[model samples]
Target: MSPSSCAVLCAAVLSPCAIAQTSSSPSVPAQVAGQLPTIEIRANQDEARADLEAEQALTPGGVSLVDGESLRQRSVVTVGDMLRYVPGLWTASGSTGDSSFISSRGSNLDATNYDGNGIKYLQDGLPVSAADGNNHNRQPNPLAASHAVVARGANALTYGASTLGGAIDFTTPTARDGAPNELLLQLGSHGQRQGSVTLGKVVGSFDGLVSAETRRFEGYRLHQKQERSSLYANGGWQLGDAVHTRFFATTIDNQQQLPGPLTRQQWLDDPRQAEAAAVAGNYRYNVDTWRLANKTVWDIDADSKLTFGLSYENQQFYHPIVYAPPFFSLLIDTEQRTLGSTVRYQRRMGSHDLLVGMNLARTTVDGGNFSYVPGGAQTLSTSVANRASSLELFVMDRWQFAPNWTAVYGAQGVSTRREVRDSNLKGDFNSINPRAGLIHQLSPSNQLFANVSRVYEAPTFYELQDQTPGAPPNTLLEAMRGTVFEVGTRGKQELGSRNRWNWDVAVYHTRLRDEILSRDNPTAPGTSLSINADRTVHAGIEALVGASFALGGSSAHRIEPMVNLTLNHFRFRGDSTYGNNVLPAAPKVAVKGEVLYRHADTGFFFGPTFDLVSSRYADFSNTYRVDSYALWGLRAGWTGKDWDVFAEARNLANKNHVSQFSVRDVASANAAILSPGEPRSLYVGARLKF
Candidate 1:
């Protein structure tokens, strides 16, 4: 097992074996014929000390974790290429897929309100809807995920919801977590193809999982096409040792052929112009979702524990479009539903560790739209509805105060309510958020950290009941706010006797208030409005480093290297309209690099990657700008025993860039192009396990 001696024998067999043996493990029996798959030394050292104590208690905010074997060695598909080494994220390409306007250190993507850009989107923890909230449908699929966690600014205020630009958790994949029985296939380049299958079972005490996938693409421009299909199922049971029950279902179908956005004189005249008179659209989407959950764990005797949960969700959307002229042929339909509940209490009081929580949520939304007029009928038809509710109470504590210091205090008390039943409008808000952190352990592998936080945001429901006829219907000017501050350091070492290293660094600052700005209507001269300016400020820094080694004498031949970086800064404080601009999908700098090689007894693997982005300002009065690019990718793999095969190459430089921009003129200065991305591609796949 090479790969750096199988990562030092999987970090000395998972380094921390006794967190009450994770609920008293017992249930080991599955060493069927041709054995060879038994290694659970305390479940690999308590999952490597619970992943280094959850990365040193989330290192003062700004977290990142991408597992599933690094998304199959970086063959990441979408979700902005799996957040391209995440660091003040800002993925691009919209009009369907890979669109995320994330802000962390140097805020201001409109002064990041709606929860201080402390973003939020979750799949396993529920909640996922940013498609129209304008985060552009970020769906990064490594076959739908087995891991993803990101929590940025103000350390995401201990997850009691309310983002100031940070939060993402997607975990999907289960079946008592052993997920097996599978099939997959692939083909590459602009003609791409993919197919998948999965099935799992344990039929006795109930445990099941089923999956399906289909994909196709023939793009890189010229008639562009894309297709998708998905189906999923989940089940769970074990309702006796303190309860557990679950159910989930999913469905998604899509069709696309929208080669619609050009004009740099049609991309310098005919860059394979196919019907390039521009503005041709077609899309069909269907989504069905259902979830029911119940969880309870109360065993207050051995180290204290208590948890309670309840969940429900429903979502739907439909779209029809054409876009050209005063906006033509458009029909949109939407629906959302949510119900949630949570209660938690945790304890391990010796060096102090506590958690208390309460949460409640309610959401309902309705949609409508119809507009035609490209030589015909249906001039307009509109209907809308809205509802929202939230409640929260939180408390957190860590305190180890000595033995290398540690402290983490948190507080949250929030309440919100909104209703816009056909523009009759109603609103209410209340908040009290606070956070504090400190960490130090300058040895045992080093550490240091700091934090401070405050956040709030409200307004969605299409930014308060969007009416769209000269705008402004159920308005509340603005109410976004944020205050964050942070500092960091991290380390790990052992590089000499055959490598191993890890590093992380951070810096952040933010200040904002009221934010949100979009203008033109100085009393209607062709309408357009959204107010609440007043302040802004941002700052950034992020760094990551990694290494691994071991080649010659086995342990399965290995190598790994990684680097990630980001730096950003923003302004705009008074009399705004992008005067001190620099925040329109801000991407001041970004970098990523990776190299991997593995061969555990002929289970060959290879990886190479590089991604960089810089250059910013795509409208919002920053007067348009979009340049800077770099991309390269490759991945290869093969394994046996349970079978696996893979290959990939993406955007290996065929960069023409420009993923999002707008400014159809408040008086001409040109800028009307939406969705222009994709220029290189390849894929090849295979997988099986039983």
Candidate 2:
């Protein structure tokens, strides 16, 4: 028989009637077996949503989880889109593309180096940002995640993140996620278009998944066009019942045109116009990166598990940020390489859970500044060579000392070194961070948590090289250190037979010393300074309330309302200069949420969304202020088991406002330093799975 005929024959042999006939007539069973060989299949499953939720419940500080499946109902072009509903997170996308200004608890709000610091970005529990605690504008594509986890401040101790903003982790999609072969297409305002493809399967002992995406946008503001392409793939192998291994590969190319910031007067006149300097210089922020990693898990008996990881990354980028006179536009081009490794062991004993881990990273950078002119003319002016490394060891224990209470404690020891070869400069830092927390069970579905922790962050190569005036780059100053106190409650409960409600609320206060800070030079057009502040304080409240009710007591229809609010109160203390001044950037109050109506049986939903932001300061001296703004939008979608479609409309009022901007010690009220938010836009997307 031909292969096709054999397949048909095999199906017929496995039919219910055939099975009964084969039992009555044994020769029929032998004939059916001739088509194929006997085999045993093994499939390893990834952690389920409930597993991740349980893990987060063990944390005694602020934490959140975002389901990627839920995000598929709307346009997700930026990190801001992925994290919009997460409390305490502040993300503002540029006029187009994934470029964004992100902060938490008033961290990394500096003007000079907005590429982001004070936060660690990770993918599948491994670092995606560089070794030196800098993001370098590298944000993992959200499309590849099964879900995302956000751990704010010292809550990220388990991940070896000691920065004020802590960590954001995106978990890769896996075969167990049951993601089918898919094709996706999107169309939006400003000549925007995107296409994506994903393939996933589980075959015998091997499980594999791969996804690729490409996007183009003409942007709302002049000279703000951007393009991106990315590819992500992973394969997992079930070596045995005791061992499992996975490998990952990722690459992304981002090409973004710079519209730059506008002066207060310029924004007032026309928020859509690009800065003259940017237009004339043809400035850009372009990056190309590729990475490979391997992770292995060993389940050695029921009570113990071990994890090992290694990774290699290569990146090249060209960015033009500073526009000088006829001499040159300050440009940076760099080739960076990094090697990282990690090992962790976990054990469960009676009432105690113990975890110990070690992580190491080494990085080398070779780059130089360019004397750039319009029309792509350039010259290599100054060269840079740098080496940096970090090593960390950590241990934690979760002890259930009583029936209703648990105590969590941990300590992390870190050693880091940074060297500038050309300048003959070097700096070394070491610190030990300790954290302790308690969790009290209010009920099976509700809990209260309290924690106090210490965090330390050393200056990166960028800050160490900015030797402007008062700050001494040679010494690199002291690392930023902070102590945080926090209390929070989270839970879900059934309001009645037809309604359910959920809530998450947290209050946190932090005292910081030797905080690294930076500002654009108000007097010098193309210069900036990086300094260490004497003292500062950050306090905030993060609250979220969500509820769902069956419309008219009918299970076929429902209404959902969600509200999230954030309050930031940051200020300086006992400083000779800028005494008691509010921190620059970030609003004092912000609110966001949506009200949606859904037909459960048909999988149709529509929602109205809103965002309200209070005014913010443009300078540390509080001389200039950015006005407050409110935005309204809508989302509608229809979902099916194998196909889905969505439409997203934003800035329906076409409000003229600033999304984010640079900062200074004191503003002249006319310095060109504001980034305009996008105007009115609409997006539509559809996906098909097979």
Candidate 3:
């Protein structure tokens, strides 16, 4: 390419919306001609970024693309910070930054702790969650990602997802996507401190990015402190003109001290006190992990493409919970390993767009259980080795059957197996999920869409390890199978120079058989005992609406208001014991949003954010209820080219309330099930990019 063409290409590549060239590109960029450093735009990165956006637009279901650039302005400590503006996905802080009790579309509707299920978590589009269908608080730190994609429920066919909550893929940046060098610092209440550094560079046909971050937080309540450190890196290579491959590496270590649940009386008296059992047992949770992955994309032809990926992970986990005399406490020493692979092919022919993919994964866990002896040594109780493997094949096609109408259809078939040695358990499962949808385009930017689909989810290790024989297959738990129907509309309307509006609303209903649920173990209050519910129903609305209005018709000054809300009605479907009882743990309603004032000329923004959650049942019997709560926060920030400064105050009212709680079959006033919310706290942060 000539110098003039190179200039144009460079401008296009550097633009915010530029797709950029693939791994194998032309000679050095135009900067080389200007006596500046050369930059190589990787092809594989371009494909990943472009495909995510394109794929999301094609799905006629609940989907969202998160803006990581905007998120950098605030204190990005947890996954909650990355998803607070997206509705339907619910999360609650679970003692630490990486641990967020999460659920979506009523998936794992009643799970009580930080370990998440139903949702298939990913980093750079490779599976991070185990194959046995448990994420278990192992989500990659969102701070390391440059952006994210969320496909809710059955809409995630492209990623070969069969779980009810669908998929969340975090995308990291290359030098072309982010600054070559960047730094972030944060300080907050409760002895909080955080720092991170990121470096990126492009050399010829190769590009690399690396980052390291660390954090420490002293709990407001006793025995709740947490410390975490993580490192992330990715490098891309151009094998040839038609093939591009990228490799990723990550390592993380987390240490957390548990402040066990409190009784109703304990909460009312002093919400900041750690549970007596927790203090006595020295309850703690710690984990160390490392992962490696590779993705290769090949351009088959002008209208066809293929992508292949492989990932491997290893982890060591230690957790000790409440004391019980004979056992004192359940001490867990576990080492886990997981390997995942995927292949996808895409093509466009006439009016039909096709996608076919395959996903395979396997996980192995060597676990040791010991009975704690207080001040003495522990005694070996039992040992087990768990292995799980899965294979999935999926295909999807969208055809424009009419001028303004399109039809979408897809099916995914999965075969899985789970085995436990020493425990002497073996189980095999198979499922076929199908999806059908239609879209009607009303205008260039307005559309109405609807979909009906099927979902299946198998039990994870958490539920399997603590089993007490209940039914056939001996002590086996049945998988959950459900049918979902949904409808929604999404679009944006520009109304003159002073106002612009955007909205996305979706309503869905699901009928499930044998939904996996958990309740507090009677003898060990709040200790989860998983069970299968015969019948259940989950219905909910996920909506988001936002508007930006220019003050006095001047673009330099504006006011923006946005709201993300989810209303859930999850309950038993005429069960013998709990007839029409609402599900426990997950709240019925959630509201989060912000209203901001911005001075574009000076790059200033100020906003007030809030969270309102409805009261939730603490027991399947509906006799125990947690109180509804509201939290308010304020944020102010200024942005300059390559720089950002921000400050925020959270839980302004300092309300002492139950932020989260474990569920039970029946509850009493003395039951220990409550986790207190954080008190009023302030945080300040700054970011510099070069």
Candidate 4:
């Protein structure tokens, strides 16, 4: 629909509600009539929550929020588990560790392995992704976050993010949100064990919180093992009523064994076994990271504020693998340092709201590779030094044209530069992307919105660097760009005798140029070549629906049902080699649902869950297809005043399925592209809060 028509339709539905609210109701109590304004004033005392709510209100597209308390009640081991109910996202688990192949709205369609550059990641409103847009699954720890916000497509403009998959911000727990003291322990199948401790306190005008978690797992697949430890802490000082400053620090040490992928025949024979080559090479990855940051906010007045923050990170990486030459192994070592800063100003003027922001990030790396022969001395292969920088400036204005109507206009200008000194490669990318949107409030609980935006993304260092011997780096790759049109509606309502219902529905279409397509080497499991496609198309529908109703006429007992569905239609648009065929490894439909019985007074809950995924082509030529699969799960938990316990069972049927795979233009029968799913597993956990 045209922008003008979309606005008119939204106005027509929302205008009546505005009129009704303006008219006084006789049902209101006389004593409370004069206190309504006062209540509204006190309602916004929680500045953090209020500010986040206002930002969400201005968004005109898809968005989702995951409560940390909800996750704490279940297994929050991986991002896939954390986002089990979020729509429009497809997460393929590489269960050996926290790594996953994640795709949203077809943004990373060809990303076969652990390539997460399409999505922007943030921690407490600060950038966590590298300057070149590269991200890993382990950075955003679910246990450390109090809540998470997801903005799909162009809806992330408020954070200066312009990308196809948009952004995800994990808000860490502070003194205000964290419990005074807590301890947790978990035990599960495959010899899994985990423990965590958290402490929070407030003294005078200073508050502080600290959390630490340690975990180990003997994975379901052979040769797959992992151990990790993480610490997150934050402290705040209140200088005055209108001024606050906070400091944050985090440290992580992770090591994981790579089980790798198997061939179709091998998977059918023994899905639990790891790839022979990977086992022989003893592939593994180890990383250590430390980060420090500070943020200060100044309330200019009740109607205006300024925020600024700076962060620094240091990391050391170690990776060992055998890609093409199976008999020899390569050890990759890298030391990386990053510096970043963000500044933002927000003000309210009558019916108008304005926000201006700027972000800067720079990263430098010293990297090298070495070859290790069996029972022989290691030989130095190649060395390189690299640097990358990104800068973004954005401005947005929200105008209340009517009592229930809001119009928004915003744009972001981005400039990025990448340099590989030893490789003699350099590139600069720049873009100015604009966006416009409209939000119409149909009622206090309902909203309708639409938006059109442009997005651009540059290739990351991992994608451009050459891993093979005597091969030049990928210097000719161009930036990918696209335009997106989206519309959505979301609401909550109480109807039919205390029954509650909530829903979110969205539809979007994106037209693209220079989409990235990767080609895999025949003999290598990890080596790939990057090529840009001329044109492509991505369109889809995402919806989530939930309902709760009392049982047996008892308000204390209720049944809740939830459903999430995603339908995608992605293809190469009139390409010479692929024509209009469907893209590889992207499922057309994915559906998940759950039904649970809850006793609110007793804090008891149990649920049955199911997931169904449709098959898709394995290659761009549409010559091979993967079979579809369905799975079932169950979970039960009891949450008391100061303690909680839970148990969960996954893959109840011990089904054999393909979790993920590497995509190629055309594949032979012995491509060895299958990553097998985990077997049936059970877990139990308990937490004590004081």
**Could you say which candidate leads in TM-score?**
2
Residue-level error in angstroms, candidate 2, position 100: 1.2
How well does candidate 3 score on lDDT at residue 416? 80
| Model 2 C-alpha lDDT per residue in residues 1-690, reported as the tens digit of each score | 222332343234233222111010011001121121111112332336655666677789899999988777898878888888889977787644777778888888787544488888878888777777778658787777878999999998878778899899898887745666888889999879988999988988899999999999988889988899999999999898878899999999999999888998899899989998888777788999999999998877656678899988888988886676774467888998888888877665545556667778888889887787755677887797989888777766666666667777877777888887777778887887889999887776888999999988888777765454664546566789989999999999998787899999999999999787888865555546778788999899999899989988587799999998999998888766778899888899989999999898999999999999999998989999999999999999999999899999999999999999888888887787899987899999999988
lDDT of 1 by residue, 1-690 (tens): 122332333233223211211111111111221111122213132363355345444346567776654455334446666777766666554434323344555433542222222366656655453312223222435566666777776575445664566667676676676666677777777676777788878766678787888878766666566677777777777666555556666666655554555555565555445433333434333344455555555654445566666666666655444444463445556677777776766544444455556666777768766565433454446676777776666666555546566667766666667776776777766666768887776665667788888766665544543323454556554557777788878777886776678877788877878655443332322223455546777778888888778887665788877888888776666534446655556678888777878776788878877778887765455766667778877777887878777777766777766655432223233333435566667677777777
lDDT of each: 0.59, 0.80, 0.78, 0.77
TM-scores, in order shown? 0.32, 0.92, 0.91, 0.91
Tens-digit lDDT track of model 4 for 541-614: 99999999998878889999999999999999998778999988769999988899989899999998888999
The candidate scoring highest on lDDT is 2
Candidates sorted on TM-score, descending: 2, 3, 4, 1
Worst ten in a row by lDDT for model 2: 21-30
RMSD each, Å? 24.6, 12.5, 8.9, 6.6
TM-score of 1: 0.32
| Clashing residue pairs for model 3 | 22-42, 22-43, 23-42, 23-43, 323-328
Clashing residue pairs in candidate 4 are none
Question: Candidates 1 and 2: which is better by TM-score?
Answer: 2
Candidate 3 residue-wise lDDT, 1-690, digit = tens = 222332343233234212111111111111111111112333354444554544554578899888667777777777877788878887777655457777788787654553478989887778898988778748768778878888899988878897888989898777745444889899999888999999988887888989999999888789888899999999988777778899999999999888888898999899889988788887888899999999998876555678899999999988777576753467777898999998877655545566667788999999787777655687777795989998877777666666657677877778888887766777777777779998776765677889999989888876664343345444767788999999998888998857899998999999999888876566653257777787899889999999989988579899999999999989999987789999887789999988999998899999999989999988989999999999999999999988999999989999887877777788887888888888899999999987
Estimate the overall C-alpha local distance difference test score of candidate 1. Answer: 0.59
